[model samples]
Target: MNIRFDLRQVRAFLAVASTLHFKQAAETLCITQPALSRLIKGLEESIGAELFTRTTRQVELTVAGRLFLGECQQAITHLERATHLAQQAASGDIGHLSIAYNDFSINGVLPSILDTFKEKYPDISVDLVYMPSHTQHKALLDHEIDVGFLIGPLDMAGIQTFRAALERIVVILPRRHHLADRQQLYIEDLKDEKFILGTENGWREFRQYIFNICIKAGFTPQVVQEASTSSGIFGLVAANMGVSLYSDCINRFQRDDIAVVPLDHDDYSVETIAAWSMSYTTPSFRLFRELLESRLGGES
Candidate 1:
C-alpha cells in the first residue's frame, strides 16, 4: 500500500460505487473503461480492500465500500459548500459591514435605504454604530468604521465622501413663542433669543454652519444650554431652555410643546453624506452605495 490516494481516485470510486457498473461509471467520469478500472484498482490497492464484487452482468459494492461511500459523500458535500461560501464572500454577498450613523441619519432616509439593502443583500450583516458626526469622521479615519452617515463636506484627508441627502434646517421652538406660527423663521429673527446650541465636541461642521448663518445675520447666538442627545435637545426646547436648529427630518420628534418651523433662506440646510476611508471600498461598500443611489436617484 505504498501508493497514495487522491481526490480524483475518491471521485472515481464514488462514481463506480454509485452506479455499480464499470461502463456506466466510465461514461459518467468521461474516462475510458480501462482508465476507470485502473483508478478504482489503484484506490482499492491503496486502501487494501476490495471495494466492489463483480460478475460479468452486474457489479455491487462490498460492505467496506458502502461505509466508505457515506464518508465520501459527506466530504464532497462539505467541499462544495466551502467553495460556495468562498465565492459568496468574494462577491460581497456574505460578510460583515461596520456602519456608523448619527441621529439625523437614522431618523431620516437611512431606515428606508437600509430596508431595501436588507431585501437585496440578506446575507450581509450590518453592525450599526451610533456616534456624532465628529466622532464618526474620526472613526472612519482610524479604520474603526467601514462607512459613516455623517454631516458636512467631510473633506478630510483619505476620506471618500458621497452626499446622501440634503435636508433644510428647521427651528425647534416652544409652541407658545411668537415666531412659532410664522410661515418661516429667518436666521436674523433668532439673533436675540438665547439659542440652545450643540455642544463644542458634537457636529463641528454643522455648529460652524449655524454660527456662519448667525454671523451673516449680524450677531452671534447666545448659547444658553447644550446637550449632545437629540431627545434631550427636544426636551430642552420644550422647556423653553431656548430654540435650536435641527435637520427637518428630526421633526418626527415633534411635540405639543415644541413646533418645527423651516428657515426662510434656501441655503439653510444640512448635507447628510456617506464617508469611508479610501481603503474600505469593497463589494459591501458598493452595495450600500447602490442602495443610496436607488432611493435618492441622482442625489447620491
Candidate 2:
C-alpha cells in the first residue's frame, strides 16, 4: 500500500510536535491556525492514525506520534545534510580530481603546486597518475583524466595547454667519466659518446626533442641502450652504461653516482605543459586550473 504524504505535512507535524501548541506552531510556520490544523489532519489521515490528543487546556502526542517524531527528525536532518553537500560540490569545495603527470613535471614543479592546492582546498581529493606526454594527449581528448602535466609544444584540436616549466636540456654522465668534471659541455661533445636514452613508449616526444637538438649540434647520438622511465635511464647512466640528455629537473634528486652537466647551447630547452580537454570540465578541475594559473601569474 502507498501512504501518500508531502514535505509540507512532515514540517507541519514537526512544528506542532515541537511546540505542543497549535496557535504557536501555526505562527512559527507563518500560516493561519486553521490551515495548520488542516495540514495535521491530512497527515494523520494519510498515516491512518490519530497523532495527537487535543483538549481546550493542552495538546499531547499519542504513542504513534512519539515514534514518528523521532523518525521525522532523522529524515529532516539527512535531507539538510544532502542539501549542504550538493551546494559544496557545486562550488568546487568538495570533490575528486584526477591528475596525470610525467617525469619533468613530477620531479620539478607539480608537487609544489599540488601541495599548495591541497592546503587551500583540503576537501578536494586528488589522484595522481604517471603517464607519458603522447599518452596524456589521447587521455585528455578521451576525457580519461582531468589534467595532465607533460612535455610541451602541444598543439591539438579540442585541447588547451599551459606551459608550466621551461627547463634547459642537460647531460647526465657517470661520476667517473672524463667530461663529468667540466663546468659545462656543448651538445657536439656527446656526438661520439654512447648514449642511454628513453624508449619510444613513454619518451616519444622527448626523444624527438633530443634528436632535433643533436641534429642541430652537427651529430646524432649513438644509442647503446634504452630505458622506459626516468629512474631507469638515470640508473643506466649512473652504472656507466652510457650518458643521456635530459631536462635540468633531474637536479631535484640527490644522486651521487651521476653528474648533471649543463649544455652550452642556449636555444634548446624542454617545456613541461599542463593540458586539459575543452570538452570535459568539472568544478573541481576548474578550481585546480585556477590555482595553477594564479601560481603561474596568469600565464597560459
Candidate 3:
C-alpha cells in the first residue's frame, strides 16, 4: 500500500490495456513478457485493484483499467507537449546554430547565405566551423553540428538534406602550364600530369571523382601532394607544385599564378547540399533554410 506508482508502470499498463494482449504489449514496449507481467502485477498491487482478466488466448481490461488507461493517455500527451514547448523555449528563434561548412562554401556561397539569413533573423547566432565533407557528415550524425553545408548525396539515416547549388569543377593550374592556355580542358587532357589533390579519404566522393575521371582517361594520376584545405591546394598549385581541380567558387582566391580552366564533362559538376537531423530541426533551423533558399534563388 505504501509503494508509489511510477510512470513506467502506467506506460506498461496503458500498452497492455490498449492492445488487450500481454504478449503483444510486451512486444510493443520492447520488454520481455515476464517483465511486463511483473510490472502489471506490481501496478495492480499498488492500486489494490485488478486491472485485467487474462486467458490463455486473450486478455480483457477491467472497468478500472479502462478508466486508468484514459487518464494515462491524457497524462502522457500533456507531458509530451510540455517537453516540446520546453525544448522550443531553450532553442529560441534567436538561438545558436552550430554549422559545418567546407572551402567551396566558405568563399562565396556561405557569405551570401549568411548575409541574407542575418538580415532576416538578426537575433539568431551562427557558429560556423570549417571542415572537410567527410568530417562534416560525421559531425552532423553525432549531433556535434546542428547543420552542414557539403557536397551530396549523403545516404545516412535520420538525416534530411536538400540540394542548395550545382557548381562545375574547374582545373586550376600554374599560369605557365600547357593546358592553362586552353579555354576549356577535358579529363583526358590531364593524363600524365602530376596532380595536387585534397587529402584522400577526407573528401571521399571528391577524391573518388578525380580518380574515376583519370581511370576513365586511361591512367592513374601521380599525386604530387595532398592538402586538407582548398586554400592550401590552390597555394600549392600557384607555387607550381601541381595542377588541381576545384569548384568555380575557387575563383575568388584570385591568385595571379594560378589559372582556372573550365571542364567540359558533365561529371565535373558538383552539388552542394544542406543537411540536418530530422529529430533536431528547430524553427531557427527552418528560418535559416528559408534565408539560404532565398539567397540561392530557391534552388533547394
Candidate 4:
C-alpha cells in the first residue's frame, strides 16, 4: 500500500498520543477539538488503521495505536535533531574546531576570542589544546589541530601564516628588587642577573630572544632555573628564585610579590602569528582567521 506521511499529521499524532484526549491535544496544539479530531481521522484513514479506541468517558490507545505512537515519537525526535543540525550547519556551528595555542595565548587573547566566537555561533563547540610553540607547530603539521596561535619567526613548510601582533617582552622581578623601582631597564642592566627562562626547548622564539638580548648586552645570562609555563615562571620569580623575561600578559597574573619592568630595547619584542595547515584552509577557518585578524588589527 502507498501511504503518504506529512509532518503536520506526525505532529498531530504525537500530540494526541501524549494527551490521550482530543480536547487536551487540541489545546496543546492550539487548534479547536473538532479540527484536531478531523486531522486525527484523516491521519488514521491515510494509514488505513484505527489509532485510538474511544468511549463516552475516556479514550485509550489500541495495540496498533501504541506501536504507531512509538514510531511517531521516534520520528519527532529525529525531526527535532534534523532541524537542530540544519540550523547549526547554516550558522557554521556543526563542525569540530581544534585550536592549539601556548599558555600565554590563554591569558592574553583567548578570553576575547571565546567570547566573540560564542556570541556569534553559540553552538560551535571548540576544543582547545595548550602546548608549547614548537609542539603547536608540530600538531598543525600532523593535521591534529586546525589552527594555531604561535609566537614567531616560524619557518615551517606547508603552513600558511599571518602575523597578528608584536608583543613587547618584559622583565619580571621580585617586587623588592632594586631594579623594580626603575620604570624601565636595559638588557645591559640584567647582564649579571640569574635569569629564569620558560620552556627552553619548545619556545624557540622566546628562548632565542632572551639569549640573544643577553649576549648583545655583553654577557651570557647566568641561568638559575627553567619553567614550562608563565604561571610557574612568575611564581618562581615571586618567590625570588630569579628574575625572568616574560610577555606583558604575565602582569595579568597579578602576583603581589612580582613586578614587571619594560625592556628598553626594541628588538626584544616577539611577533604573534596565526598559522594553519595549508591543506585545511576551509571557508569557515578563513572566517575565523578574519575574526582573529580583526582583533589583532591585521585584517585587510
Clashes of each: 0, 0, 0, 0
List model 2 lDDT by residue over 1-300, tens digit each: 885999999999999999999999999999999999999999999999989999999999999999999889877865774576588779976787889999889989899999999999899888899999899987887667889999988889999998788889899999999999999998889989999998999899988888888888898888999998899999999999999988898989999999999998776688888999897787888999898888885346
Q: Which structure among the candidates has the greatest lDDT?
A: 2
Residue range 156-253, candidate 3, lDDT tens digits: 98988887777888999999998898999988888878899888655667888778888988989889899987878888998899998888887776
Query: Would you estimate the TM-scores of all the predictions?
Result: 0.66, 0.69, 0.68, 0.66
lDDT of 4 by residue, 63-173 (tens): 999999877776676566457557767887765466888866777767688689767866567778877888887778766677898887677888888776677889999
**Top TM-score prediction, candidate number:** 2
**Which 10-residue window in model 3 sums to the lowest lDDT?**
291-300
Question: Where is model 1 more than 4 Å wrong at Cα?
Answer: 1-93
How far off is residue 84 in model 3, in Å? 15
How many Å off is the CA of 8 in candidate 2?
35
Q: Which stretches of candidate 2 lie over 4 Å from their true place?
A: 1-93
lDDT of 1 by residue, 1-300 (tens): 454799999999999888889999999999999999999999999898999999999999999989989888877865764575578679976765778988788988688788888888888878898888988876886567779998867778888887788899999898888898998988888988988867777656677888988898899988889887778888899898899999999766547889888998778889888888886465677888777776676432
Listed per candidate, the RMSD to the true structure in angstroms reads 17.1, 16.4, 10.5, 14.5
lDDT of 4 at 230: 75
Using lDDT as the yardstick, the better of models 2 and 4 is: 2
